[model samples]
Target chain A: MTSPQAPPALRLRRIYEVAPRDLDRAGTVSTEVRRELLALGMSPDVVRRASVVCFEGEMNMVLYSEGGRIILLVKEDRVELLFSDRGPGIADVDLASQPGYSTAPDWARELGFGAGLGITNMEQNSDLFKIRSRVGKGTVVRATILLGVPFF
Target chain B: MKLADLAGLLGAEFVTGAEHAEREVTRAFAADLLSDVLAMVQEEGVLLITGMTTPQVVRVAEVMNMGAVLFVRGKYPTQATVEYAAGAGIPLLAASRDMYETCGLLYQAGLRPAKRKGFRLDLPSGPARPAA
Candidate 1:
């Protein structure tokens, strides 16, 4: 008997590589993703939620990580975002999720980010959220926002 | 209020997106932190009032579908920032007044705070107590 064929992979509407050379270009990746989501006919509210989460993730990567990538996955019922970074991982996930905890350098603060609300904001904006990190390895953040659902 | 009327009310200069000056603004939010602004300002057509003059500010306004942005405390966006806002079709305005005074003027002009229906805080129920 022939082996069962593997199921097709989940559809990926778009993927963006967010490797900001410097802090000045940190928001570029998020901006691109937002435009793509809007063009894909995602609801405005859904796009906003995803944009906020992605923006925070992008800024964090620029300020802390050596590099990272953002993937935008669109499905019939929901939109998903994945952010993975090759950098110093979070030592304490719980502490990092706190509202006012930050390890950003002074320069990062001067650029108007690093207020320490990135992770918490991401969690609050998305309908579903998950984070994974290893001290010496890297970090990954996943956020999902369902479509056609009233956020309120 | 319309963007034009808001500009006049705050004596703001139209930095960009004059084509959208007639856009209606139903609510206002004042904050320097982008995350707070994103989390709390929930409605479309809301106006963002802030002192930060960076491209990220425009990015936030675009994502949130805000009608416009008013820079307070005489702050002005750089050329690149203005260009970005214009490209994004988000009008940018600047007033010399500080954030507090600017928000006060807008409030007096009937612009209320944006309702955050997504996140609401309620006090815990308790037994009735005597008033002090």
Candidate 2:
């Protein structure tokens, strides 16, 4: 998840795993991520934004992927959330990112997921965002919310 | 408005976190779709109105920092969901009224709607103003 826009370095925290089709455990990882961010005394704005991003990514992984893991990266000047999933990867990232566009299954749709807003929401809340996917291989999303930025 | 007063006005039964009655919320975002909630709720300390009563409802409120959740149409969350909300400090309430009347009462009682992109929320004055 290296990027020129990211700060010089970051301390990696725990990696949260999202299980496939586990409606019972869907929100677990996002809750844990929120707890850790709160424990670290991160700003409320950053924590809320990060948690929303994490929860959306977690839900996407659970709803569509075989499974996935989210890694928390805490840099002195920013926080990075990385989601990598083993799923039937998207054939079109651009098409997938469009609002209200989703390939989510019926059960997931009934549960109010697959709004097709997942990627867009993550991108909006995040100061820096990137998604990389190989059609048959998998997908990865990295969202960074910078801290102490003057213009933020 | 205080959560307790809002609950009382709506005749809602507290499913959890009655102790948080004193907390105040001046805005609300009403939606049964969890993703819509996630996408649109940008304010903390607001009420979330929904017809869904699954644990996911509470989870969404928690992540979004909603002050409390109001379940309409007589829906109620499960035991585990209530317990989870208690632990998370996000209160839950269930009202017998359907979504339409429930939102009407809330709006009439002064809980403004949460802001949305490209949508103006300002209620114009005069004859056009919605009756309380």
Query: What tens digits encode model 2's per-residue C-alpha lDDT throughout B7-27?
Result: 899999888889998999999
lDDT (Cα, tens digit) per residue for candidate 1, span A9-80: 454567767675465677777788888887878777787788889889888887788787888887767888
The parts of candidate 1 lying over 4 Å away from their true place are A1-11, A148-150, B118-132
For candidate 2, give the lDDT.
Answer: 0.84
**Poorest lDDT segment (10 consecutive residues) of candidate 1 chain B:** B118-127
- The worst-scoring run of ten residues by lDDT in candidate 2 chain B lies at B118-127
Interface RMSD of 1: 3.5
Considering every candidate listed, which one attains the maximal DockQ? 1
CA RMSD of each candidate after superposition: 4.2, 6.2
DockQ of every candidate: 0.40, 0.39
Top lDDT prediction, candidate number = 2
lDDT of 1 by residue, B1-132 (tens): 999998888899899998888899879988887777866877788899999997889988988889899999899999988988888899999999999999888898898998676553222345688998
- Please state the Cα-based DockQ of model 1 relative to the true two-chain complex: 0.40
Q: How many clashes show up in model 2?
A: 0
| Residue pairs clashing, model 2 | none
Instruction: Mark the regions of model 2 whose C-alpha exceeds 4 Å error after superposition.
Output: A1-9, A150-152, B116-132
